[model samples]
Target: MLVSIDRRCIKLLQELEKETEFVSIKSLSESLDQTRRQTQYDIYKINSLFEFDKLPPIEAKQHKGVRLMDVHREWLKDLLDQENKKEDSEYNYVLTQEERCAVIICENVLRNGFSTLDDLSEQLMVSKNTIFIDMKIVREKLKEYNIECEFISGKGYLINGEELEKRKVFMYYISSIYGLISDGMLDYLQDEDVKRHIEVLHKIEEELEVHYNKGIIEKLALMLHFSETGENTKWNFPQKTGSALVCVNIDHVCRSHVYGIIDKYMKDRSDDEKAYICIHLLAGRMNKEYYLYNETEEIFEELAEKLVGYFETLVGVTMDKRGSLIEDLTQHLSRSSYRYIYGINDGSELETIIRREAEELFNVVRKVADRFSHDIQCPIDDQEVAYLAVHFSSHMHRTSAKKYRYSSMLICDESEKKRENLKKRIEDNIPLIQIHEVLTKAEYTEAEKNKYEVVISTEVLDINDGYVLISKKFDNTDHINILNEVLQSRADEVSSLSDDLFDQIKPYIQKKQVGTVRSIVDHFFGSDQNSTLTQLLTRERVKCLGDKDVSLSWRDAVFQAAYPLLADGSINRHYIDSIILNVELYGAYFYFDNGVYLTHAKDTSGVFRSGVSVMTIPRGINFPHNKKIYILFVLASVDEKEHFGVLKEILKVCDSKEKTEWLLEAQNEDVLYKNLRMIAEKK
Candidate 1:
């Protein structure tokens, strides 16, 4: 594909603005000598480039007239500076011009084989600042040809690095920092050795201007080598790494997936970084092993210290002193396994296990470590640490947010044979969980304040408001049935709470409500069928499907279910899930956002099949708007099937397309797409 020159045109316009700050369309048109429309066309072109590339957008306050915002004034100045430099170069074609002067001098210095930056600056009659900026442009342009301008502290810049070797290094460097997140860099700390490391990085950075501009840490990773280049880019390796093997198993099942990271880390970066990051991601799913490497033990230990230090800061506690915190990682992992004892027979039936190993795999410096939360996770009864999502931080500040369950409460009845055995089972299954408490009804109160928002009860009990009743009995009903029931029950509680809360604040809402809403509600409540209609309206979307008019496949079911509710205006919070799922089943496309799907349903792929929506996709997986519609299916029980709209309702609540898409894709049928591994027992 050919690249449009919008960025260049924007650059030109910005420079024109700077030179003539009070310039009109007439002046701008005269500068380009084009039509007034063409001058405006340039501004539009500028916006498109900035919008697409995500460079700060050009903000114009006035709609009709040309204007420059306060924020853009600096950029305008820079633009004019560039234009002046260009004009100076064109008129004064000899290399004496300011912009060309430094490069010409550098070429002279390189031809002489050696000259310090001071000498070059003196020779060029410009400040070191101007010289450096000129060299900055030089280096940016040089890397395209696989050339690197080597630098020394006292010495000036020189592209004298061996051509072949430099090209390889440049490629490596580019791949490393392409999307490199800056973190883990030691600062000027209390320790001398740590300072040494930062100093080493600093000195190397000066010589590696291109790499600093890019990220050198990313280059160090070996896994993402071939991601940026086209598939035919002559660099190839064995298809899968050992870490890839490990991620394959639980990547889908894990609460937070690294697949997108893996994909992005694979394509837009270098092989080393890709592979290294993948290894880290795999270690993230420690104890729940699919692939194990020789260095798993060492790697797991390092990651632990990093996590501990991070949590200590987040939770306002000093967790552990950070040097190379590798020796006592086993102790740091709150507890190694979890056995969720279902209380139906007091949690014995759902005595399932979840394990988290690799507790102390991350190594951190104390100051850097002190900035994080060490209490990121811990396991409890019936609760398993499903995932450990890590985020990068710069120095000691949290550059990103991570979701780590600190402690999961596993509620069970106390009639088991032995407490020791149950405790052991829990420790073995849930590695990241600490022995917070083995709670029965009495113990449940003790463990009420936990990390999970809901207090998971083995059986339905009148506990606190936030207590959740998890089905301790894991009988093989249907996967969709399980999720649909759980989600709907939760939504119902939330809806009830919302209504009660609204009633409390009705006076305020009535005062604040715009005329349109007041008029509509008053009109409806005044009707004859107001009582019957109120019940239906309060329940949100009420379906009155008289009878099946035509034969329909599972593909068309969701849309069929939704069309009537939408028309009737009964499609409220409650009806969205059924509508989405019906559409997903019939149209073969799952419409969803994180547990919410209804609002995002309308943008359906008439030909929808496989898709994953994320706020940010690592591999850039986008919905194929023109692809054939896909039909989502599930082997659900009658109750779950009937209540299929429950999922759609959840999607609408989440209001996140990615979440809806993930759950929908996760809940898709194997008989239809042949990818039932997400939520199915394979025959």
Candidate 2:
């Protein structure tokens, strides 16, 4: 009988086998980063498995620690070696719930015959019950692509959907889940056929001066190989009515390379099949420059303008680098729109990170992206929204007055795509440090280390030059470390300059005035703290008008919300009129879905300073279309950037259901202000 053991037990067994003599329990625990008790428990489990297999168990002595006998050590080594080999094979590797679901979908869609529950259970190394549950999840995922997973009693399971839709899901699963076409996936294709397909793709790339991501290359190869192996009959092509750019490019490719190459291998392939290949190529192309000189450039340019215009109106700030922003957005939309329309996921690894780090910008872009979705007649998902957020964030950083104090270099071994992504993340988060160059380990030189103030490497360096080592997955800790380094470098430079300036003027000043001169120098070089939401929306600015004796109209509620700001002279009466006029023209565009009306006008003609006022009415005020507003926030700003911090905080409150509910439940101004302060502090 084989007994099950956790990974810790396996690791402990390996450690014991490696020791030539007895090792102390403390040493063993330290090696594994666990308590002595936990290590003992793991040893017990390992011994149980060894006893079941009739092998020599680990020998532990009270004075020393633990060791494995030669016989048991050899057996354990073999067992571990086998496990390692299994792990190296994708088919034998364990899958997460999501990965299992994706594998099931891929198998059902790509396999020639129906797969039974037993087949899936054995393949995934899970129980039949787990496979059954996974199938249900697989069905729901397939439903998103308008596909269905069907089962017949004795026939097993199969997916039924439009051929193109099924292909889309299959391509997505193969590209995203498996990450590449594995050996198991290529079981049906001959090595020669696979090589031929790759050669054709390479020829196309060379002719077009464009490259696809490795994963995309594999996906296209699989598609081509399958098409040659009699899958072409089921392949259906969608109407080619959109941009002729891809088609024109494909025409050139076919004339130059594809026709000559296909004649020798896949001569029977139809034009429809070739068209399908072109569609995938268009969606998967890595470089944006390919779309720059296309005939559809003007159309994408117009769409980019509308997107930026919509974003500006929503965020209330004129973006810097308007021409560059439009051009970059056009390039992105030209390709990304196809991915959305064809249901191809670009597999952005930064989407979740970007969404979390730039929540305020993501929310604003998500709202603006609705216009793009409408234009393409396809819903833009969070991955695409995250990409848009990066663009806007880079724009925001450029337009800000914050200076980049430290020049930096990034040493990353990732692909060009990933290097650019890391560079963007660093720029977006730590604007004070500008990455001057990205180099691989081979390209990096010791002489270049002294050129940059800050050197960040994804991998550890042999020489210790005080370079900051960060993980490939750049997290908040790495962000803070880089930021601190940049700020410190700036401080050091400023301090040196200030000391020299003060010394030069010291002889001309009196002894009593010396302190004042040093203070002036320090103040001149010191950084100023930007205004925050908590500073603007103080206790005096918050109000809880619960269960009013008389109902108030929307116009009256707007006045009531702005009363605090007006009373404090933060705004004039005309500011109130501007807010009402904005509502009348834009039809409550400021009203959020979380029962909070954040009313603000772009016109700051009647504003004196930046201020925020919050008010909650339990007896909701009547607005147009009988919409009741429970919580209202009025913002008055002298300029765009001054109120931005406060708006971000307000947007965060509006984004959360729990935070909005807590504010709504507050019965008095004190409670509301306390809750608001808590939220701001948490951020």
Candidate 3:
């Protein structure tokens, strides 16, 4: 069984990932044809012996649904890939002509960490004597560049060329290898669906993976799979190797007819008259809206510009700053939305319930959105963040890799010197490098794709379908990574994946998930308390993504929201949670002032006090929606003179709009349920 689920299987999984709460014992057993007992044992070993992951809250219960830890479907893929890669391969078996060239490139890189030999030589082959004419042809190719090929004594052979020419040589080398691998991938994934997906994933790679920012790339890819098939896949190879994401205009997606259904009954419950595009999301209501943009880029850009315009309109009232305002808001949304999401205890039961038909999920989203919007008495779509995903996908990849720490030994002596000076000055100003690094080349390669930092190079760049150049600069010294910046860049060689809505986000957020929320927050918000909250918001937003067939469980939202609050920058303190979760068994019913004053505080303990920013955490994955619990807190009160005793009851209400209005009308102590002190002191 172990062998059956061996390296190849793992590698396959790495290539194809999905969104799933946890690695299933039954799935693994059936896929690998092992006993469930053995599967369980392997999971145990993975947890206890291998320590692959911390085994996130294996027994922790979701407030309402079945709870289970979500493992990146790609994990299975990567683990399998790693295992397969670990298997032995002869460094030099019967040499294929192409593999020989790659070997030569590696050898040169080992020697100088760079290379400049261009011609494909046959001298390393055992049948070199029979291929004398091919060798002559190779020699002729080298002569065009003033390079020379000669046989050496003990070492196979050496190609003599200046170090300055290394960029071209390396470009050709990677291109050759990429062509082979890309073709191989096409063949390996012969299944029609798999091939289509791979194609889409390739476009995502072109758009988002970027200059090896592994985390974002991985998450984006995993999420893409999750979006399409409702499966979570943990993949490592593409991320580790490099990938990209195509940007998507979420608003355009939301407004499209395919996004949601036209149910006349939904009208009474809905908040908007505008056309509604629900996509795979569950937007509860009967509404309509017009949408534009045939592709992700056009749509994302349109939405971003519109969203930005709306923000601009709100400038005097909402915010004052102009520069990087969108980025700042993006960070804000990323942090503020997590309070509503959580992990489940038994994922299977929850999956069974939430494992909806596409239409069902879509309807549920509409219902949830309509209901929630009604409860809040505000259009959720009005917030700056409501359209965040749409705009975020728009310009995220417009900038490319900055050229850093990379110097090409070249023939243009003075230009090269100028480039060097530019590098130094830029480095002095933006010294955060030694990471987010790129080896971009400014020189062109006949091989069609050039992959080197162009920031320091003076070489003339040509724009083709794949010839991406990171042209945007913050100054002479600051620039985006070229790999992701040039969205339509043609590369003789680059990570290729299919482009879809999920594919775009997948490439951007894939690997970034593990600790991404914190890192991105720290970068934007730093030690500020709001940073933690901001990441929660982004998590909140992410939780709401995907096909509505699987509604955003309040369970996940609740955990995402509060889990971040417990964080204090340091990993240690962040894990310690002091809060508790509770929901009414019969549902959170409204009680007028005339209702019973509870004899016991514990009975009312599960009830949130009014005026607090109430956050509802999800129960187990399969738990019913109403059973989800919340952390209620008092946010605002009517007259400042309201007593503390009355305040406690105000925070308990789960509904925000109602909570607000209730506080507004209160006139006497009767409106105030028992205060915190009374509840604590009571029997």
**Model 2 poorest ten-residue lDDT run:** 179-188
lDDT (Cα atoms) of all candidates against the true structure: 0.35, 0.68, 0.30
CA RMSD per model (angstroms): 28.5, 13.8, 28.7
For residues 1-683, write the lDDT of model 2, one tens digit per residue: 23344445666777776779999987887676554545765776677767777776788787787888888877766766766455442112345576677667766774556789998888777999999998878876677656777888998887777665666666656554533134232242346876777877777767657656445566677656543234255444343445322222344434434345444444566654554566555554324432323444577788889889877766666787788778777776765665665445544444545553456777778888865565644446666787777666656632222343468899999999999999986765544457899999889998888888789989878756447888898764576566446545655676777788899999999999999998888766553223377778878899888575337778988998899999999999998998888778665665665678888877788889888999988767767744567889998876666667677778866664556887888988899999887766551
lDDT string, candidate 1, 1-683, tens digits: 22234332644455555653455665566554344434555676566655654566654444234556554566555544654455432111122233343333223322324456677677555678767766766565444434466676766666643222232333322322222113211111324543443454444334434123223333323212222333333322112243311122233323334434444423543443333333333332334443333234454455566655443332222332334233333333322211110000111111111111111112112222322212221112111221221111111221112112224455667465544445444333323233455567665554364454434445556655445454444221221232233334344544555455556656766565745554554443321112211222222222222224234432233444344344444334334464345444333233321221122233222212211211111122222222222222111111221122233222222332322344344322222122222112110
Question: TM-scores across all candidates?
Answer: 0.23, 0.51, 0.20
lDDT value for candidate 2?
Answer: 0.68
Which has the higher lDDT value, candidate number 2 or candidate number 3? Answer: 2
- What TM-score number comes out for model 2? 0.51
State the lDDT of candidate 3 residue by residue for 599-661, as single tens digits: 111122222221222232222122233232222221222222222223223322212333334
Best-performing candidate as measured by TM-score: 2
Model 3 shows how many backbone clashes?
A: 147
